[model samples]
Target chain A: MDLPLAIQCEGVSKRYPHFHLQNVDLSFEQGTVMGLVGPNGAGKSTLMRMVMGLIGPDSGSIRVLGHAMPHDQIAAKRHIGFVAEDMRLYESETIAFHMDFVRSIFDSWDDDYAQVLLRRLDLNEKQKVKGLSHGQRVKATLVLALARRPSLLVFDEPTTGLDPAVRKEVLDEMMNALADETRSILFSSHNTLDVEQISDYITFIYGGRVVESSNKEDFLDGWRRLRLTNPHNRPLPDLPNIKEAQQSGQIWTVTVNQYDDALPAQFTQAGLTVTAVERLTLEEIFLSIVLSAKANIQMKVAS
Target chain B: MSTSIVPQLVGKDLRLLSRIILTFVVVSLIFIAILAAIWDHVPAVVQGNFGFILLIGPAGTCGIVMLMKTNVLEKEKSTQAFIMSLPVTVKEFTRAKLWVNLPVFGLFWAAISAVAFYFAFARGLFPLGGVPFVTMVFLGGFVAYTCILAVSLVSQNLGMTVLCIALFEMATSGYLWAIAFLNPISQHIWGAVAVWNPTAVGIVAAQLLVAVSVIVVTLLVQNTKRDFI
Candidate 1:
């Protein structure tokens, strides 16, 4: 399972006057999309900036595609295409003008494929960049970026402020962009479903630190929500996987993050009913993860 | 080879710059044309010669706007995203700007020179002598543009722009006074230090010195401190 890595950062740090992004480390392999989710101002954009070589870290090295960043950004960026919700287009120029402008600069530009995206995204070739709606602007930026055939496509909340239909269009476009197995994408979002639907790897960033980073399916595995009754009044077994247990009167609810095949038998032996074992979706997992991380931070702050 | 991103970056800047440059060109052309049409009507040589000095205002203002405004424009739009996404390094971005706009400012200076030559020739029927006039124009413009560049690089807002201009003037005026023995009339007289006074040789040397210093400062400012990116 050795994957050729695309980006790697170790001991990277950045500090503002009041806020600090302390010691961050992250990595992603080639061809795998990594979703970075965090609360607003949680340093998601800052970290991305560092990774893109838009800003250099105060200390530590960053390697993207095996080249050191900021020092190597010029070469690295040849393969990297980035988009933000606030896509900066040449406002006074038409979409065709920008296509030519970008095309002249990058030899890899695919004019035919660009036309295809323009038609598929329902954008006008002659439309002025300033006149396009926000959703259309996103589409235009996406088309410009995608047509370059960039190996690393980074989207920073590409769906923000987009209507549901436009969001789906963008999401579908992203999936299409991934049809090439050697290409990769990194996008940050607050929308868990977007990540769950598309990402192979998910990293949860909370309060300037990565609280969780793992394969998407592996994270969803070994966790469950259980609802049971305490009517028989049997003491629960010493379960290694139980994260939290709550009991009210004759009813008990339990959450186990590390479950095994013997769990139902063990519950039966303990004279308690295992009424349900339901799976937690990505959104639910996000909520639970955020709550636990916040609690952990607070406990550390208190101690 | 990557077609130096500088050109791409400058292409975007020239769009915004043309508005200011066009405005200056129109106004300067009209003023110069009107002055040429009325040169014989009655004016002191000193008044007219000094008026030539004031042309620096419009041209210098245009150059400063071209450099400073374009530098901050992307930051103003979406400070977090615009520059952060670009692969253009801060040094390359800043140096491209400082170096590129010189030619832009040079074009403005050249236009002003043409206007001055038209005015001078129209005033005198023949042999008006162009070297001194063009030299003064270039000298005045070089001083104005570079001083403005130094200040604009460090300042954050309009108030700071005003303050940078004021500080630059105070420092250079000190040099102007010291060079001539327009001598500080006081006894605590290091006020007569070497940094002040503007004589021809000293001023020309200072112009060259400022040019080199601009390169260094431009590199330092862009490399050392970014505007909260």
Candidate 2:
């Protein structure tokens, strides 16, 4: 049996006066969490909006849950629980009003689950949204989205601008929601810690293009920071996945996307002594990729 | 599931505009009471000439201002984000706004027109010959209303909304004066026999046509929006 994909974006490009998302092809299986990591103005929100059918892509096709986006979006959105940083509840109304409103629209609304989430999220149903704190506001949104029991949850910077405690609470709730194998999640964030903690897959995008995308373990295990000593002041070794290499005196620090046991042997045979081969965290890898991508752009522009 | 969303959205908009609805109801009741109290003791100076103005003036002004305030003139831009996130298409949203807003103005327009017509044609307090003129003037309210609603829904720009309001206000005021002095309407203004001259009927018919056309054009324009957010 073939499980349907939750999201698919092929050759999806959106152009603005100041920004563009060019030919982004992405997909996630039915039961996995994909973290989209990108910097400010890097088109993460644009991509998410395109997937939600909020904005039509300038070119290419987007399919969410097997429905063509922006065309069958009304039908597609029935199974999508989307929350963005800019999206907010009615401020003048009480939380109960919003809950009732959402419940009336969606037959899949789970009242029992909504009540459970209200307690776990520490939200008061009677409290007006304007009176809630920032953390409470986010929690209320989360409660509303989760209680709908959508097949896919898409979050665009959901935990942005929250304190550490609130961020952890939100992440914990998201992880708890993903326990069902049939559900899928896609969240974009600048906070790599949040992404690293809950993401099953990671995709790095920069300058309106995806630079790296793979399983979380593969990314973590495959990338490494190598510390080497060129005692004879030799040139840097040629490696297929060498992303960035910097030298100070006779010591060299090389960041590679593909790292394995044989990499040390290759460096040794190149007349360089390998001193330390340390694994890179997701944050470090993201930074290295972005920096390398920026340098490559500069080189192309210069040439 | 998607079929029920339009009603759901319309229901939400009604809830959002409930305060305005209540205020409208209250103001209409007070005006009706005032008209009932003054029915028997009309001043000779105002009698037989624009007596219904006292009723229609407040109703028309309040109808326009209240509709614009609750729907078109919203500076907060609230509820849009939440509404857009749901399983609603642009057509559904536009339909909901139109469904909720038009009837709101219609209710007030109907009540005010009914009260005025009752006193004029049925009770014989005001001259029946002025019915066509009053009808045409009240229909002017709808023209202003459609202008504001269409512009606000399409542009969502404060400047354009204000411009529409200003143009409609100036045009309505001018048109009312122009129609009141027309030979066909003023010739039979104080007469006992009710008259539906070509000018009066033509103006009323034209106003209704504009109202319907404005609504149809607005809905069609709204359907063209690809970027709803």
Candidate 3:
């Protein structure tokens, strides 16, 4: 039996005065985590907001846990636990007040899990939100969301402003939440290291469009930075999947997205000697994809 | 459209605002007590005019503070996003705000109106003729509040909301002056008995109509809104 999708967004488009997110298709299966990595103004937050039904698409269909969007948003939201970097609790209220508020609304709220998160996160329940530090506030929001036992958790830059130790604690808690194997998460972050560590699948979004999305292993396996030597300084041949190329005298460094065992032979057949082949990290790969996409758009505009 | 979540959200807001509401209520009752103690010492006109201002002050301030806490500050502080994250639609959120805020203001308004009514007609402090004018003034404050609430909901912009409040306050002052000096409604102010003249009745009717219309239009606009941050 196939796992049902936790979220499905097809032909999603949203147009603002200065930005347009166009023709996007995205989905992730239940029981998995998908990391959405993007640069600033890359529409990651916009997409997440749409997924949470905080905003509607200009034209597209979105389904969250089998409920249609904006129409059945109330039903859809009951199962979604969303936390964004800018989301805040009532400043005058305490953590316990918020926890009680959430508990009253959600029948699935787990008090035991809430206490566990409070202990693990080192959050004081009686502390007012205004008195807590930034990291504490984020943890409080996370605890509020997590303790609800939501089937789908959507986090937008949840770890953006945390210290290293707290980030690890948050990531670990998120990992622990998935032990049931029926829960899913879609989190967007600029921290590629966190994404690489926790994501089962990775997606790269740039300039309001998805550039690349696949399993983490496939992403890790497919991209390579090759250092080639040209003794006679002959012009390089047109190569497939060359995301970027930089030259210095006889050395040419080429980045390719479709790396395989046969790529070195293809370079040799073109009269170039492969000096070194380096595996690209997710950060490097993400930068290459974004730079390449930007170059493509610039080239099209120039033409 | 989760009717169930609406009450939950309303309950949350009430809990959060309970202290502020209590503070305002206590302050209002204190103002009334002060007026009652000074009722015989001041001249009748001074007591009637100045005392009315003192009586309405706390309730009006309460409405403004409640509006700011519930609507303006939430957006300014980004807590609206947290509220939106709950299992609620924009409609349900609006409904909760309306349900929580309007009644709190209504209760304050009604309480102040009751005390003013007791002093004016029951205890014979002011001429019974002043009852219509007092009712119009109280109703005028309610209309102003509803208008401000509508603007806050529909615009969701701090600048616009502030502007709406300022404009309504100015309009209210002007309306008060016109009714006191220029309108035929003033004829009944010093009469021996309360007179329900056409002008007095018309002004009251119009105030109610505006208050109801503003709220209805606000809900309709919220229903069509596609994006709420």
Candidate 4:
């Protein structure tokens, strides 16, 4: 099987009473990080849960690391480490107890690696799970998941409770885990910057559907905001792949997905001044994609 | 990247069930010591009397661990990206629970049976000698195991389950005199349950029935689509 893709999901559909997760097709190759970004209730968590075999999709085929879930999820999970935003550890137990308990069960557990992570994360061994601060709790979860040294690590909103400083450290540790090259990560987050910072590929989910998925650099570079003046009073052609456009006074600011050096010349021949053409950041691209999806939905409703 | 594939579902299940078994052992040993202390003075057969407590150990512990994140995919981070990134199947995941459940019950059953055997010999209470009473006690332990599995597998509230055990006895009037007077109106398991030689094989039947029920529920859970509301 050439060790099938780490995640290969197709035509995944899940319907809710008020919201429907539509045809969520996504894939992540081995030895790469894929960041999943979506607004709340956009089905980011739902997708992650399905991958973990925590939940099943309404209609879909999912193969994670060559195992057809969740029939094989048990066997497959052995090599996988998962940490959620609000993972509940035994509140009454000391971190040491949990460490010992987790260590005893998995043959892959590295006691030496665990010790190093604990110190690096600055967590005290004697600290009780309940007594740990929210950031400390996240760090503790990371410590447990990381030291196990699984081939794949799945983090769901891992940085949710951490402050900026803690978040950066956690991200650095995550990056450190991926330094081995064979290890892969799939994380869901609202923080686009985090998504942009570490993700080799990015997927945008909005209102239970994936609006966009592409390489991070390609996504940012693909989007262009060009300034144009409409001198002929001619409406722009309804071009396919033109995600969105905005008008300010006589200037028409158009957002195009596949931007090129030729864009300014086309507007110049139309007797409109081509003032500026600028590349958009991932955050701006994310907003445009979401807004465009909303517009598509609204337009569909109106007609 | 060790050559061996990871099996964390079963692995985690083991860790989870270990604490549960530990708890049961701790609680059971305390009761056994108490039973050993009271064996001579009490008229009741120690083997027959302690069946219910023994039954609840394995399934109850597994249930508590499961309940810890019962809502993991339900109420918490059902992260689409993260969960999908693993290397496992849903059925394999659910099977890990059963793998953990059976052994836990097996351990509990083994422990209590040993205790029951010891207590039966130490105490003089007998059903024409304690062999038949021992058989009956084993049967009750089986029923308790099955009942614990059935209730824990399906139940959402741990407190209510424990309460149900107590309420059920109260409702059926399970005491000896109540059994003597109300035998005509008594229920199936309840009527003969408290007796010296309660039907051990019959309780085994109940256990099988519960085991089947759990399998059926698990299949339903397995095939059903997870929307994660």
Candidate 5:
């Protein structure tokens, strides 16, 4: 039997006068966390918004928790906890008012957990929302989202403006929300450290398209940077999966994806001594993917 | 449909609605009392002149309430974000907008107008012939309020709302001025009894029809919105 998916999007596209999300396909399996890593205006937020049923795609289909988006969104929302920087709580209302308001709508809201979060987050229930700082506001939204214990949590840049201490606490709370094995999370962020610390799977998106998506371990293992000494100055081999190459005198640094143990033999056969092989961090991988994609686009435009 | 969705949204806007409603009621009552006092003491010529002033309360009330609803509640970005994030459809959101403005402002307008019209005709403060003018006042307010409410709901854009108000004001001023001087309505203004000429009745009927049509059109347009955010 095929594994169940919390979210699935195929050939989904949206168009704006200045930007377009083209032919995007992505999926998040049940009981897994998928980190959407991208820079600003990379369509990460747009994709997350589509999955939350906040925006409708111009073409293609999206299913969230097995319900068609923006059509069965009401039913899907019952199981989805969405948090974004643009999403806000009522300013004049107190945290208590919001808690009651959200609790009124969701039958799954847990008062005990809500109380725990309020205490843990150090939020005053009687305090008005506008009085809270930026970090506190984000935490308040998180408290509201998590207390309901949604099956799927979708966060769009939840930690963008938060301080370091608050960011860690929020990330911890997210981890706590995921203690249940059946729960799944799909968060979009430009912060790779947060993604590296929390996500089970990683996806890189750039220029309104997904560059790569895979399990975290597979991504970490598949991309390697090899430092080699090319004394002969022989022409570099046209190796497959070579993302980028840099040279200084006789030393050459080559970055390759889908790296394997057999790659070293190929380097030796080419008469190049492999001095060192270094694993690429998530941030390095993200930069390489974006740069490579940008270079490819530039090359295509030039040609 | 989420059974509690509309009410929940209504509750979100209830505080602002309550404030506007209270202010309108208190201010209208005071204005009506002052008008009644001036009617008792002032000369008949002055009474005839200020009788129309009694309507300023309800008309002003309607305009104020419409302004508050559009400017403070629905059109604000934070409030819109909060509302659109809820597990409610655009239809439900539109219904909530209608619920907040129409009934609250409608009831306030009706209550104040009834009291003002009662003093004007029933209490014999002004000639019953002026009934058509008072009715025109109420109908004009209803049309303007409905147009503003409809535009705010459908577009939720402040610029469109301002444009609608400006156009409604210009059109209302022209219509009122034309009726007061033109053939049909001006002929019956100072008569002994109130008269409902075809033109007067027709204008009133058109106002009612346009009011209801705008509301219906707003709902229909909101239903077709694919992107709630």
Candidate 6:
């Protein structure tokens, strides 16, 4: 059976004086983790805020757990656990105080799970939020969000400023959150490795637009970097899904998005000798996608 | 499942601000006690002036601090996002702030006003004629506070919030100086019986009107806000 959609954002757009997110459409099924990968100022937080109903879109509609956004937000938020990088608890208050506060509002708060998380994450309940280090604060907030046992989790760069061990710990806890199979998560991060590790689906957003979004496997399988021999110094032939091309002497490096077994045969048919076809990592793929999109926007402006 | 989260949000704010609230209340009460103890030692007029200064100063500071902590600081420190993450809408959050701030300040205002009234009129500490003046001053403070609260809620900017407080405070000083010299109010400043002249009543009525109007307008404006955080 097809899973219900946890989030559906259709043609959503938001405008500011300096930026505009235009005609964006995104959705993901329940029980799947969708990682939103974007560089700074790429509108990831804006999109997540819309999903969390903290802000309304300028146009189009967003639904979280089947409830329309900004209207049914109070209802939709009941099942959503949101933790953004900038989000903070009461500074003078203790972690215990925050947990109690969250417990008071959410009926789904699991005390047992909270205690487990606290112990596992090595958080001191009596310590004030102001006194905790950055990593500790992130962990505390994560515990608070997770202990609510929300059906949908929306995180915006949860592991943004952390040491490697802490980042891994956070990523591990995120993976653990999925053991239930009913919970869905949409997390935004520029850290492609974290996204690649935990996300079943990956979305790359750049310059207020979604550059690419697909399942992790599809992303891993569909992108390839080919080093071709161009002894004749002839121009590269037109190829489908050519993301970027660079030439150094007789060697031509070309990145393609729609890679398949038949791509090499097509290269041969075009009088280009494929020297090597290499799989692109998510980081390389993300960078290529963003650069390609930026180049496209610049070309459009020039035209 | 569809119940309003205003109460819980209000409760959370109350809990977070409990210590500050307690400190202000205790300090205000102690100040009142010290003033009452020295009531006969100092001249009545001087004592009354001191009392008004002492009471309004701390009360105003308390109200400003509360507004800063709950409204301005929440946005500045990004705790507003944390609160918004909960099962509450921006409208509900605004309502919770209204409930948290107005009533708490109202209670503080009313309690101190009652204590001042009892000492002045009931305890015969000052002439009853000062009642209308004192009431106007107290109500004026409420109006100033409501203005600050409204500005804090709408702007959510620390600079604007502080500017609103400063401007209102200066305006209040000017208002007090001007009203003290008014013929109707000045004539009754030392009378044995209280006089409810049209000027005194009008000032008090206007303060109440402004206070209520600011709060209502704040809520209406907040309801229309599309982006909260």
| Winner by TM-score | 3
| Model 1 stretches with alpha carbons more than 4 Å out | A1-4, A232-249, A263-272, B45-54, B79-87, B117-141, B150-159, B165-198, B225-228
TM-score of each: 0.85, 0.92, 0.97, 0.73, 0.93, 0.96
**Could you give the CAPRI-style class of model 3?**
medium
Best by lDDT: 6
Q: After best superposition, candidate 6 residue B133: deviation in angstroms?
A: 1.8
Write down the C-alpha DockQ for each prediction. Answer: 0.33, 0.62, 0.79, 0.24, 0.57, 0.86
Runs in model 6 deviating more than 4 A are A1-3, B122-126, B181-184
Best model number under DockQ: 6
iRMS, all models: 3.5, 1.5, 1.2, 6.6, 2.0, 0.8
In candidate 6 chain A, where is summed lDDT lowest over 10 consecutive residues? A231-240
Docking model 4 quality class: acceptable
- Mind giving the per-residue lDDT tens digits that candidate 2 earns over A183-302? 999999988989999999999989999988999999999999999999998877777789989999999999997788898898899899999999998999989988998999999999
Q: lDDT scores for all predictions?
A: 0.73, 0.84, 0.89, 0.68, 0.83, 0.89
Per-residue lDDT of B1-229 in model 3, one digit per residue for the tens? 3446888888888887888889988887788888889888988778778778887888888888887888888888999998898878888888888998899899889988998899777878768888889898889989999999888777777899889889999999898888888457778788888888888888899999999998888888999989998
Q: Show model 3 residue runs off by greater than 4 Å.
A: A1-3, B1-3, B181-184
Segments of candidate 2 deviating more than 4 angstroms: A238-240, B32-78, B118-126, B180-186
Error of 1 at A66 (Å): 2.0
Q: Which residue window of length 10 is worst by lDDT in model 1 chain B?
A: B185-194
Clashing pairs in 2: none
Candidate 6, residues A60-122: lDDT per residue as tens digits? 999989999989898899999888889988888899999988898888899999999999999
Chain B only, TM-score of each candidate: 0.72, 0.85, 0.92, 0.56, 0.84, 0.93
Q: Is candidate 1 or candidate 2 better by TM-score?
A: 2
